[model samples]
Target chain A: MRTLAQVVSWLALAGTLAPSLFYLAGGTTLAAVKTWMLVCTVVWFVTVPFWMDRAEKD
Target chain B: MAEAPPSSAAEPVNEYEREPVPEKARLGFKSFIGQYAGEHTAGTELMIGPLFVASGVAAFDLLAGLLVGNLLAVLSWTLLTAPIATRARLTLYFQLEKICGRKLVTLYNLANGVMFCFLAGSMVTVSATAVGVWFHFPMPGLNDFFPNSIGWVIAVLAVGVMVAIVAAYGYNIVARIANYAAPWMTIVFIAFGLVGLREFLNATQTTLNSGADLWRLCETAIWKGGTPLPGQVKFTFWHVTFFAWFCNMAMHIGMSDLSVFRYARKSWYGVATASGMFLGHYVAWVAASILYALQLLRTPGNTDVLPGPLADGAAGVAGLICVIVAGWTTANPTIYRAGLAFQAVFPRSSRYKVTLVTGLIVAVFGMFPAVAMKLLDFVALYGLILMPMGAVIFVDFFLFPKLGLTSFYAERTGGSFNVAAAIAWFATLGIATWLVQAGYTQIYFVSLPGWFIAAGLYVIVSKLHQRLAP
Candidate 1:
């Protein structure tokens, strides 16, 4: 569970960073990044509490 | 009739005012990332982004300046604030009491609490703009200061009550809201940009055939570098960079985030701030700027900068929802912090009661539309007022022992108010205010110098005060 949450964290970071970098690099459209961001955001939200609970055990 | 009780009479929960955070309670890095992202990419972005366009910033300056300035902000968090927070694991007020003494820290808490209420009020105003859009209430203009309609007032009150209830529930609720809202807000902000971009391109008949064309459109239509809008300052690259960097100086360099980061398992968790800097300040800001630019394009004479109408015009009902949620997520935590500041002064008071009262005060302030209209200046002023104490903390924590001066001098001597800390805080503000008022330097530039001034004053005065002590 901890490992999975860590993976989700990285994926969440990537989801946020990619679109921002894409826009900065002059990508005018966000068609592709939107779907990617949505999935990552939902997954991150679900997994975070599990990780937080895991921290409790440690 | 029964006699009223004193303001400090109530009891508090989670008042961990005198101790370090327990090991089992520490949070992982990802928690900070979620909180920062949600807090920073908020309702203010809608207003602030538009103001940047109004200030006449060019694309290169806005973009490059934000990159550099935000990087500096992240470094300040990672290197300056997080280390001390993880070491001490105390709230900013407790830490201040140890260094500045209880009496002085109470005064600082008063100022901090009041400032936070006003800031949260501005967020309430942002949310109210969306409500105004839905009900077709008369909203304030860019230059308006007071609520123009009863509907606007009612809307603000409703939003304020909901935000207050959530805040009074405590940090877990606030964090949960942020985590849930952040991803959605990010997507909505991106959508706002896309819709605005398409609208602008269609309206102007500009084809995005090449990068050069997009750049040309950005320069001409979006952030046309020229004279600022009426009653605003012209913003250059340096202004954008410095403003972005110092806008949250209180939290980072001022060490207020000690409360937030103290829960972190590692100081390097401070890097989590990057999520907010990039996503909210960078992307959301640019998106909102695009929306405002489109507004200017459609109706050259209409200069109103209301976020609700701007966003609703861009993304309709979804945009309105974003404004409210963004405001709530941001203001919930903010009002919570304000309550903590006030509660620190009245340590026996219930945090929930204090938070409710703080939210009410914020709502009252929110009715005065000027707080939201002039948000850029207000945020800068907030940081300036709070930052000197941060400087004192920075120096006392890191530089004091190097100079053979004892740290936490107030605690060490059992003094109520450290004269050296008071002098540093007041003197720095006095000089910075004078510099701005006397036309020596602008507000954005004064803080950097004031930081150094405060640090130097603290070291010298602390040394003198220590030697002169009985």
Candidate 2:
């Protein structure tokens, strides 16, 4: 479960950056990048809490 | 049956505030790296980056200045601050108490705490800008000093109250959130720069086929060096360099970070500050500058440097969220620290109440836009005010024994105040302030001479005091 959460967190991190890369490279619209980032942000906050503070607990 | 008093050894220690950190508790280099990175890349960077653009810094000057200045800052941490932190393994407060005495350290705490409140207030202003984006309220402009509208006041108050309450009650939760948000916020800041650059290119219909073309774009469209905006100091390469180097002078040269670095296993771990300097101060500052430049290109007459509108224009809602999170994360700790400082001054006071009051005071400061708008000057002044005591500590630690005077004079004498240290701090401040007021030096450059002045005064005064008192 922790591994899954970590993987999702990493992907969400990548997801936040990916749209901007696409926008900068000229294919995607700024609107699309914004939308994608918002989605990634939600995913991040949801999954990250599961594992982000676990190290301190252990 | 009354339970036997809990074993003193079983009680968790209070971060080793009054003693050296035990070897078993020393942290690795990576801990400092992550900490520095998160702490530096904050809401204020958004304000600072835009202020650089407003100051009319050319591309070469900004880039080269930041490169050299940040290098100097990192070296200061590694050489000046870290060695003492590792050798003594003590908090800055405790170290200062040893050298300057308890009463003087309390005075220093008051100064430090007040400065923290103002700094946190600026963060509140930054976050409030985000609130303005949603609420369509009139926010403060670069030159405006007062709250401009009812909506703006409400926005600031709401944000400030939320932040204060969280800091007062849910500090641990906010800290955890800050940790989770750090990496994400950093990436968003980078995205702001990229998206702003793309927008500028599209607006200008410029194609970057070569390095020369990009340089031309940056020089012509981005950092077109010219007269500074009204009420801003014109930035030269020297100004940029000094600003970057001394921006955190209080932390490094002022030895505030001794508290943070005391847990390090090795002094060289101070080099880990590079992660923060380069990523937050360099890249984030440059990125923020690009966004502000884009704002100017779009509306030549609109000179308001609101981070919320700036971020929103670049990355939309994500940008707004970035600004708020960045502001809140930074402000949370700052408010907490300020509360602790205040609580120390009023030892019997409840920490939660002190922190809540401190947060509200910061919010009030936020309502006035001048603090955030003039952040460059405010930061320089903050560093200058706190920097002299660092010199005192340095001299007391290294030079006193050589001069045949005892180190930790106050500790040895069991005094509540050390007159020599007090003279050094106040006299240096007076001289430095006079120099700036007399137009002999800019605030950005005053600290260099101020630091030397402080060291000299400390030694001379200590010599005189010891001879007379003994």
Per-prediction DockQ comes to: 0.12, 0.80
| Chain B TM-score of predicted candidate 2 relative to the true chain B | 0.97
* lDDT string, candidate 1, A9-55, tens digits: 66774664465456444564444444555565566566766665465
Q: Tens digits of per-residue lDDT for model 2 on B86-153?
A: 99999899999998899999999999999888888889889999999998978889999899999999
Index of the highest-TM-score prediction: 2
**Candidate fnat values, all:** 0.04, 0.64
TM-score of each: 0.87, 0.97
Candidate 2 Cα outliers beyond 4 Å, as residue runs: B1-13
Using lDDT as the measure, the top candidate is: 2
lDDT of 1 by residue, B1-470 (tens): 00000010111225565798889878778767766776677788888888888888998998898899889888999999999999988888789999999999989989888888888888888989998887898888888888888998898888888888877865566555556556668877886786677777778888887989999998888888888888788999998988888888888888888877888899999899888888878888899999998898899777788889987776566567778878876787678778978997888989889999888888888888897788778877888998999999989988998899999999998999999999999999999999999999999889999999999999999989999998
